[model samples]
Target: MFTGIIEEKGEVVAIERTGGGALLSVRGPLVTSDARHGDSIAVNGVCLTVVTAERDVFTVDVIRESLDRSSLGTLTEGSAVNLERSVRADQRLGGHIVQGHVDGTATLLSREPGESWDDVRFSLPRPLARYVAEKGSIAIDGISLTVTTVDDESFGVSLIPTTLKLTTLGDRQVGDVVNIEVDVIAKYVERLVARQ
Candidate 1:
């Protein structure tokens, strides 16, 4: 599990296609400093196991199913990605509980800049709409953000300068795809209600 707290921004150094999957090597000095084989790391909201670690880079194999569900499949060498290590057992949860299990992808619809921050609106998938509420939490590309507003088709989130600089949102443009993980608690609540 992760707290959706980004540790550092990493760059994809290589992506090799295998018979049934692909191997991704990312250069993240901070996250790789103590990373060992089999450690879990969140890459753009997708949890992947470390297959190999050397120097400032670590490699993970992405299976066909994960590729089909995330934007990671489209990444190429030199692409920048958000990276986060698993939260410690005793550390305070800086962000909400994030499983690093992306539910789906969302598209950047527009961005409105403010004096102190920017409000980014994203196109929400219909199936995930009900789980998102105004002021609720959502993980976008592994960064935890709050929903500023929500409607049937979209939701907006206000981003502070720190967030913009620390994560990939600073480079996002209209029509770009991003990984999204809705509040996991909401899904459990929905399941309980449905069985009633």
Candidate 2:
């Protein structure tokens, strides 16, 4: 589990592909400072296990399922990624509950940059539309953001300067793919209503 609060931005050092999986070597001193083998780290909205922990780099194996479902597969060496350590035992929920279990991907539709902030609109998947609402929480590329507005096919999120400077969303352009994880509570509500 994670809080969607990005601790630091990391860069992909190398990618080693296997038959059905790949091992990603990432450089993040902060997140890897205390990281040990088998620890969980959320990398660009995907929860990956640490297979090896070196000084400032760690390795995680990405399986075929996660690659097919997330934007991580498109990452290459030198690509910047949002990195967050797993939630601690007694920390406040600064952002929403981010399981790092990406449900699907959303494409950037448009970007409205303001003087101090930016409002980004993304194309919403039809099947996941009902799970999103205005003012609800959504995790995009491991960064928690609120839904500023919601339409049948799209939604908007306002990103502050801090977000724009820290995460990859700052450099995102229209048509770029981003991993999205909807609020878990909304999914539970939908499931309960469906059984009634």
TM-scores of all candidate predictions against the true structure:
0.98, 0.98
lDDT of 2 by residue, 117-160 (tens): 99999999999899899999999999999999999999999999
Q: How many residue pairs clash in each candidate?
A: 0, 0
Question: What is candidate 1's local distance difference test score?
Answer: 0.94
Error of 2 at 196 (Å): 2.4
> TM-score of model 2 relative to the true fold?
0.98
Candidate 2, pairs of clashing residues: none
